[model samples]
Target: MGKDAKRSELGQFLKARRAGLTPADVGLPTDGTHRRVPGLRREEVAQLASMSVQYYTRVEQGRLQASAPVLATLADVLHLDDDQRTYLLELAGKQTPRRPRARAQQVNPQTQRLLDALDAPAIVLGRRMDILAWNPLAAALLTDFSQLTEKQRNYARLVFSDSEMKRRYAGWERVAADCVAFLRMEAARRPGDPRLRELVGELSIEDPHFRQWWAAHDVAAQTVGTKKLLHPLVGELTLDWETFASTTDPDQQLVVWTAAPGTASEENLAFLASWVTTHSPGEADDADARADPHAGRGTPPAS
Candidate 1:
């Protein structure tokens, strides 16, 4: 989609939200009058929001531009959630999704060190959820990102296009839907990003679910969450993941996945690390070796 489509996005988002609510839902008295359209009418929204019906109609029709404050008011009136409100305001030009500097291609050395120090799966993601880097544990738990092309090392790409990814997740459709929502949030944050545009276009063409989910206009930000994976090697792992943003790079974030201390999941993680050490040799060793300077190096020369 282009600039015109941006207007369409804003309009559709508003209409979708409105359609999701009813007169009773918003505490409006039903006059027993038959409704022409679903949800609250434009007049009711305008009245409750303290705006003119004509203005609200124009805004919904994507004909007139409204101020950020005005859009914020509408967001409140619509009872938008935090993510939804942010997405709505972003679409209304209250924020710039475009980066002032170049989109990040690499993570800082300190960040990489942090990943190396972790005992669990860790990954650094750059703009458009590209797999910028990952710890060996992550490589073991997830696919070996090192073996993939740059274009192929994307979260959305893998979740949608890779057959193994579908089987990896216990509930593939929910995970895939969330991936689409995350991409939508990123796309809103950086409108008309060519690379982002290309990613969406490709997924829309090749994947059936991608097209529908993308069209849903849902937006989501990564947060503390739990993921259940059926690992081919170690079996089931229910990992908890948390996402932390980089202060230097807004588009860069670190995601760490760990299992509870004494659960079977944690034991499986240990087994996975061992499997990596055995198969890849040095890429993933025991927990202490993860902190060692030469964790995976060969035995030292005899003195």
Candidate 2:
């Protein structure tokens, strides 16, 4: 959608969510008298958010563009949870889609070499979260994306559409939200990429949860975090994760996973790494390699 349309939609969403809250919910006094509006007064919101009443009114009217920090402050004052916070930011045009520069025709050989050298699981992801390249260790640590067809290599798509993702990650909800947030940020960065639009369309149709999450319009920058993986062969693993921007392809990112030293989860990750190397395909150069290898291998991709 165009920025204006998106802003209007976001504004409506914020108003609806805000109106649903009662003053007492946030520990404010409610007179219990007849009311024209359901929520706190605009002045009350402006005071709490450290904004002027006129400016807050302009924002609610969709006539002002708010800065990121200001929107964040307003979200906090509004008692917005993650989803609501995202919605507020989007409404203020803080998360508009971006126009990406043209992509290179070929992946860099040096990048491939770097992936091959990592003992920790690491994959090179396109701006839209496509699994552009991964090493054997990376394949072992997570799902074997290198074995998938070109069309099936997207991480965001897999999380939303593939059932296996739910089973593979114990903290699927948080992971899913973060994935959505990342994609939202990417959308702002590369708004013109047709592939990104297609991925969003596909996910919106295939998954109800994705449809709900997409409405929030959240965006997140890459940072170190933790993830829990339930490997079919090796049990559970809690891994520390980091993401780095590719120097050659700044739009793409390298996501790496490592477990804490001397932990049982680290040991489990070690076992799973060995398991993926032997079973997952080293590359996707043929139809046979791209075919669904998970057939009868495990439960239907999460559920």
Candidate 3:
């Protein structure tokens, strides 16, 4: 969509969402007099967000793009949860999806082998966090990749759309925002890819949070980070991850997750390995297919 059309759509959506709220919803005191607007006035929003009324007006009018920090402030003022915040951003074109071209090679066989050999959970993922290839350990720890279609194997999609995956994450809110920021960074790196674009579009339409977070224009590259996972079989584990670029493809990264030695996380990892051994591949595949990533998980009940 053109900038104007995109902006207008987002503006209207925000307006409608805002109208549903009262001053009390955001801790503001209403005068209880005849008010011209359904929601907080532009001046009230600007005061709460610590911005100028003109700037807030520009934002609501879709005449200017808001930075990540500014968007965060606006989200706070609007009492936007993760989904609403993300949808607002997407509507602003602050973030565009990755669009992968069919002609491009997303992953190399050698890299896939490297992932398979890693004793710990590891995966070769594309710029958009697509599971190009994941080792048995990674599949066992998370979801079985064999069951997911090439299109449904995205990390971002799983975070927001899959119930099991969402439950696995300790802080779903932080994970969701990080995914958006990371994807934004990837988009800057691979602007020509059609798969990225399609994924972004699909997600934007599917979740309001994705749309709002996408609009914030945040960029992040956390190649090495810690993720807290609540494994169904093994309890909670904090896994440290490291990402390395594939030798053959700069766009592909090998992500590996490891835990501290002699810790409870190590014990959990061991348990995950055993789960993979007992569960039949046929059973897992059927379950994952039913958990399609593009399918919408309706905006989580406010907060």
Candidate 4:
């Protein structure tokens, strides 16, 4: 058997999922019921899963281990999707398997070369959405990674901690939610990752939206997406991004962005690159230039 995950984590995941649903959501008749809590009661969940209230309660309390079938039934009753169900099982330390070891934010030279060869903006992300590395075009397209400290160089921090990010994206909520969802997925995958936990804890305490969104237990493994940026210099830019996982190292991801040919977005990118080359300080490829230090963006308090 794999290393046992914290029973409390399983309990929290189940409670979060349960809180996101109501009687009406599961086709149960609602007769103007006044409930203290926001979602289905423990008894309701037990009834839906055909389990004893005591057993379900014990499972939720992390006092008892949830067998595979019990976990599956609970997942079904909770209406967990593929990614969420996987996360559920991982949290329970049931059928799901985990990587032998967690990885750090180190990229391959060949991968870096490939990233540099791309004309479009690109970033290499770690398991927790950390900005492991980024190319010149990426720096030009987004905030310069070098300008940020390690803790600030994260999607969640950038999306919630920085006001600039809100003005940067056209659909800030959707994108920020996606970022939160992705972090949730990683949380289950790396339940014991200290850095990942610190990232979540920091966001949870500092950002109210992050705290609420995290409690919803949403999970996402989006490989491709679109981001409409209201770029300050070049105006609006519509870019499509693709994430490629390394064949050699699953911990690292290569995310590349591109705009459709003949679109103004593409022209904007070209002009942006030229501006970066001509006006920006330091080497285009070097992770050096600019300064944007902000408070409360440091690493999570030492655990």
Candidate 5:
């Protein structure tokens, strides 16, 4: 569907959901006085969603793009079911229905545990390609994420801004192009996300390469692939990569890098793991701090 039509449909859906809900249904005090409209009023919905009545009115009129959190809040206030909640997010151009307390960059404990358990390189990525968390192997394979500032931890930013990343990836142009395409896909899903816009804006200004690729209008979903990297420690290595989406939070993905058993790449990975184990713990940490001077700074909210 066209963007305008989709927005209008989203507005209609919101209105319909609101109309089906009564003040009592949402735990609001109700009087028996005659009402001009059915269900909760616009101001009531705004109040429940913690937004301004004028803003809500503009959203219902299809004149504003509602953020994922706002749509999720409205869905809850309107008592929407799971399917309805998904629909609400889809209509709002969001990849997933965000819970009120859910932060896009926060990885669940279970996911973190899984990352820690992995023998190979693994990283958790948000919808905006921000590196939320990474395993020790991931740190060994790529740059140590903890050493980079949160803003610098993003895949797109590293691909464009870090000269070391360009040198690490053997197919730099192809990898950089794919990152741009995947970002384009994310842009379509969350068009109203200010963080995404900011990331794109910063990249466009900083890198002419990013500007050219973004203007190509390419769009791609992250999936299984093979990446050839020239790691400083492990030397040239080809690893198979797979992306798995989180069932609970569709915006979160676990990207794993592994090598085929009995291959030279596998042996190299094993060697790298052993090297990391034998090295002084403080050495890696110190190296990371030196690599990126601005480490430990928090990232901006992805929403």
Candidate 6:
């Protein structure tokens, strides 16, 4: 649907739902006078949602883009059911049909085992592009996932915010553009995701390049691709990468970077693996941390 039409529909839905509710129904004390309009007032909804009346009015008038947290709060205040909540999100252009919430950052035990068995660098990615888990080789090839804080583990954030990332990739522009496009696709699929919104907001302010690319409204999915990575220890390596959707959790993906057998890239990858083993036992501990099977999921807010 067109953005304006969808927003109009959203406004109408909000107004209709508001008209059907009463102050007492939502635990609010109603004035004992005869009312002019039906249902709870806009001020009441704004109060319930812990937002200003002007903001709520603008939302009901289709003049503002409601964030995911705001929508969730509104859903609660309005006592919306699952279907109605879904409908509200869809109307606000926040979610799509059958799109689940972003996956937690905990990799399952079996998945961790599979990651450890992989010969190439393999990492699991959450829906919002967070590095949920990575093998030791992955830590060597990419950044050490273990060393990064939970918020810093996001691929898009690293692409735009970390200066070292630009030097690490031979085709920096292509890689950054692709990451931005993939993030755009994710935003479209889950507009109410506060963490995703936060990532975008931070990148937009911090990186003008990201702001321009994001405004272009390009959308792409991350799948099989090749990347030219300049490992500090080893020279340049051209690696073919593939992404596999997790069978158990659709929101999680397994990303593996490999080189063709007998190629220089393969030798370089082997060298990197060996280098990781010899240089960083602490990194190996990070890999073992991934196997804990009880790591808590870290949730960063969007707003």
How many pairs of residues in model 4 come into backbone collision? 0
What lDDT tens digits, residue by residue, belong to model 3 across residues 75-124? 65565545566687777656633323345446666776777677799887
Estimate the Cα RMSD of every predicted model relative to the unseen true structure: 11.7, 11.1, 12.4, 10.5, 15.5, 14.8
TM-score of 5: 0.61
User: Which has the higher TM-score value, candidate number 5 or candidate number 6?
Assistant: 6
Ranking by lDDT: 5, 6, 1, 4, 3, 2
Residue 235 accuracy (lDDT) in model 2: 59
- Say which prediction, candidate 3 or candidate 6, comes out ahead on lDDT: 6
Residues 115-170, candidate 4: write the lDDT tens digits: 88888888898878988888887876677778889878987789888776676688
Model 1 per-residue lDDT at 258: 87
Q: Tens-digit lDDT track for model 1 on 62-90?
A: 88878987887787567565567778777
User: Which consecutive 10 residues in model 3 have the weakest lDDT in total?
Assistant: 294-303
TM-score of 6: 0.62
Off by over 4 Å in 2: 1-101, 276-303
Name the regions of candidate 3 deviating beyond 4 angstroms: 1-102, 281-303
Better of 1 and 5 by lDDT: 5
What is the alpha-carbon lDDT for the whole of candidate 1? 0.76
> Over the stretch 141-177, how does candidate 5's per-residue lDDT look in tens digits?
7776777887888998888888767776888999999
- Model 6, span 13-59: residue lDDT tens: 99998887665444454446998889888998999899999999999
lDDT of 3: 0.71
